[model samples]
Target chain A: MTLDLDTARRLIAGTRSAAHERGLKPLTVVVLDAGGHVVAAEREDGSSAKRFEIAHGKAYGAVSMGLGSRALMDRAEQQPYFIAAVTSAVGGSLVPVPGGVLVRDGDGTLLGAVGVTGDTSDNDEAAAVAGIGAAGLTAQPAA
Target chain B: MTLDLDTARRLIAGTRSAAHERGLKPLTVVVLDAGGHVVAAEREDGSSAKRFEIAHGKAYGAVSMGLGSRALMDRAEQQPYFIAAVTSAVGGSLVPVPGGVLVRDGDGTLLGAVGVTGDTSDNDEAAAVAGIGAAGLTAQPAA
Candidate 1:
């Protein structure tokens, strides 16, 4: 399945709806193309604008590295220098957080990703995961 | 125009080059997915720790709204409530600042955006814009 703009948009809308239904706080939901590009992004009102972009970075970084942003965050915690160096090496394209996941189709085909932010990392992750579920997509665990 | 991870990375690298070439302080750069979600982000060494997130927000907000952060900032000045409403509308996905630009392709599609911080708003905007240009993508002005 291609993570085209239409699909990406649907994912984001679903994410937003879940957040709204759950009375979740403002959230930043980002959609990426299979190539790890932006397809659709939206931030619930009153959520941190930064979350919108940061979530994207985390998701994109995860997609690019095939790992979750939290893993990077963990690495950053233990090896600040290495993480910092890599951060420097990549010119700031990598951020570690739990706000990212790969978007997959029914058969596990890579569709793209939906990243969410604006709450605790766990909540953010839940929101994104829920959103993906809403869209009939699966979220790849950050391995 | 699509904003792929590769292009986003190149844009970020170029922004850093420009900053370093000018001996600017470490900065933060953020790349959002096409859905105005974050795809990649980095905080330069010596830059504010929060810069990473803030810059990401600025860019994410810009992409989500399909407008420049600066314009959003201006709107925030007089219509704080309106800006606030936007934040609520998208779950806090709107940030009005001067450091974000829309990422587009030659065909003018909304791919995503980049935001930078750790310098003056002008400087941040410059870096983000430069990053987009370096990636061979168009950074469109706010409509």
Candidate 2:
């Protein structure tokens, strides 16, 4: 099923709850549709102004590359030039990091992605996973 | 005072209400801080994939130029080369148009700007105005 606005909002709520529980720094969360388009995005009050773009880039990259951003990070280390070129190719929305998690259905269908920022990359990924789980979906963050 | 996330979300809600009341097409709304950075953004379910970029550009142009985008539209018409140059200088986030309205405080202090897209330019501006008013803020659209 498509990622609707209600589900996207629920994801953001869950992400925020996770961050709050762990006392993470202020965060920005972005939810993207399968087409890599923003469905909803929210930035915490004290978050740096650039957080939205960074978070959006993370989600967009995950959805566009068809791989979790963590895998993209591994690929980036092996082929930095290729990742850099793809970043340019996507108009600078590809941020290879752990925070971008791919959303998937039970049968392995891609739904969309959720991106989180303003914490450590691992924390961000954990928060994204919590969010997707809260929405009753699976998160396919690559190893 | 900085524009908080709650206020920004309220603004978006009001914007959507206005668009819905007017029977406008699916819309995207973007809220930017005084620094011309996104605080929040949302794309309607059926909005085009490009709507977020366009809305953000409109708001960024308004906040960056210190004038509503309607005035920027006029300036663009009178000095296309200058506007074009500025657009490139801002990393292509300047969209000179009517849908961008400046947010202001009672004493005329600049707050931020909101951009709406998906309807006619005039209609979009109207929705922005309605949203700002709904949030108990003033809307400054350059004459």
Best by TM-score: 2
Best by lDDT: 2
Task: Report the C-alpha lDDT of model 2 over A29-120, residue by residue, as the tens digit.
Answer: 99998988888899998888789888988888999889999999999999999998998888766889899999987887888999999989
Q: State the C-alpha lDDT per candidate.
A: 0.75, 0.89
lDDT tens digits, residue span B1-143, model 1: 24567877888898888788766778988887665556677787788667766887787788667798888988898899998888777644556878888877888777778888888888777776766777788886455
* Candidate 1, backbone clash total: 35
Q: Write the per-residue lDDT of candidate 2 for residues B4-78, one digit (tens) a residue.
A: 899889999999998999899888999988898788888888888889889998898998999999999999899
Best by DockQ: 2
How far is B18's C-alpha from truth in model 2 (Å)? Answer: 1.5
Expressed as tens digits, the lDDT of each residue in A40-98 for candidate 1 is 88877787647766878777777666666667777778888986677665433665778
> Model 2, DockQ value?
0.58
Candidate 2 residue pairs in clash (backbone atoms < 3 Å): none
